[model samples]
Target: MPTFKKNQSSTPKINKDNLNMAADAFKESLVNIRNSKTLHYIQRQRKKISENRSASEKYTEFVKKGQDKPRLRDADAPKTLQERGSETVNRFVKYVKHHRKPRDERAVRHINPKHLLWVLGGICLVLIILSGVNERFRAPFRDAASIVVVPIQKGINSIGLWLSDRIEAGKTLAQLEEDNKKLKEQVENLTMTVTSLRQKELELNRLQELFQISEQYTEYDMVAAHVIAKDSNKWFSTFTIDKGTNQGILKDMNVIASGGLVGIVIDAGPNYSTVRSIIDDESYVSSQFEDTSELCMLKGSLTLMEQNLLEFTDVSADVMISLNSALITSHVSSTYLPGILIGYVVDYQLDANDLTQSGHIKPVVDFADLQEVLIITKLKETSD
Candidate 1:
């Protein structure tokens, strides 16, 4: 009994006044520490922690307001930093419990192992039958499959074809452009060759005509010249020759082409000459019929030149001038030589005065296409 005596300790009784005094003393001590420079950093850190806690609490409150069921963290008041990890674990557990689904007893009852086996057997049998079917029996099934698969195949094929065609078209277009350039160059070269050949042919023809003219006028000396330029305003009315005074060509020299008289050289220089053609408004030639003694004058007319005709005036009324009669330069001419072919008569009529007759004559010289000429060195006054 003497060994069983327990040591008794006195317990201090805490009233409301004592609790208040203790709390006041603790608060005063905390205030003093907060004001101390040594605890400044600790105070700042504690303030930052308090700000972070307020922000986190506000975010949690906002989340709770938005949700139909408040989260466990949001249901409770703000927690200390030490309790955050446990709160997160509790929230995760709650989330898992909330989303978990209970097994449906009705669904389990609906499924039968025997029924599943039968369905599996039926599927296997169908697969085996399909695999064993003959080609003829499988035709309908293949056709049905093709109805869906063929269109997709065709769409892919069409896209591929379209791409191929575009690629081919691009290549073809480039090739065509290159070919066109080559063809154009070839055409230009051929055109130049053809032009050169045509010029040579024309020169040969002129030479032949000059030989004939020489034979016809054996008494007269002639110099061959090419018509280099013509007046644009009055085409064949005035033209320049290549031959000049150096070639014995002089002023008033009779210029003739293949057919007959072409023009009279009005201006002659050392290396060039200008000829006034018969079609010029200022030109006048003494002409007459080859068979008849009837005399007339051939003159240029702008209005009649378009029809390749010249005006024939001063013909005797009694003279029976018929169509197609050969007209030539008369000996009575001052500038032109005698018997030179002028033109053939086309039509005749009485002149405006009725005292003389006039007619239309188509010149023998092709003035429209005059290219070369023969210059008769001997003038009519100087000729024998």
Candidate 2:
């Protein structure tokens, strides 16, 4: 009967509040375990051991320590070069063996990079001080350093010089190219200026010649004009002038250039006028020799125009005209003015009719090249 009775007090009470309190306590314990200093120390130690076990990391540490305290060679030291070399080899083998073990098992400790720099600077300072105090050690140390560093310094200097020279050469080449372009432009401008000056000079010369011709005919009222156009032929046989009725130019007005008679204005317009020179096929002039006063006829011929000559005919057979006689416009001419020099006579012979003489005469004007002219404004007066 006693075993069968349930013990209510012995059973534990279960509730939501107690379950929540228990869960809170368990979470706080886990947080404390995660943030424990002992656990952090163990993790750091494990990381250091892992790093120490690395052969490359251990070798780096060993080399860093060796550079920390560079010792000067003592003159009285009994240790020979072979002993030092064997010691270095043995120490390297020991470091290799220690790299396979844990961090606590190795004798070497990790050094900071900043400490290595300070150690290197201190060693350099010590060497400099010793070299200053001891002259005997200074020369040998300097010589040994020069043996390794001098060639490297000279090579660096040579490379720097070569680079500097290349840069200067590049700059010089660019400057030369720019200067050459500017020089070419200058040359082109100079050439154009020279050409313009030459053209102006030629124009000046032509104007001077026309001025002289104008002076020669001071007795007559004249107007200067430029030849604007001409016939398709090579000669200035039939041409047009810049002057017209607007300039008081009229038909039959005499045009002269280059020290001789050029043509007569045949048609006049408002702004332009046409002229027919003596070299044309239909042209003729009553003429006479200036020295002899013998009457003759000057006739134009296109065929003889190539030779720059006109034919003189109707000379009396007994006129006795000589070669190179000065031919002039006779006063008896109805259209032409009196005493205007026309041409010179050449090789007169008896015509087929035998009553007259015929020959060629060279005109004074160069018809092949005509530019300007003088127009005699006064027409020849005719009496009834």
Model 1 misplacement above 4 A: 1-218, 382-384
Candidate 1 — which pairs collide? none
lDDT of 2 by residue, 105-170 (tens): 444556667888999999999888986786454455445544564446446645766786788777
Instruction: State each model's C-alpha RMSD to the native.
Output: 39.6, 38.6
**How high is the lDDT of residue 7 in model 2?**
43
lDDT score of residue 139 within candidate 2 = 52
What is the alpha-carbon lDDT of model 1 when measured against the actual structure? 0.75
Worst 10 residues of 2 by lDDT: 1-10
lDDT per residue (tens digit) for residues 273-341 in model 1: 789989888889998899895789999877777787888999988789989989998878888888888
TM accuracy, model 2: 0.43
Q: Candidate 2 clashing pairs?
A: none
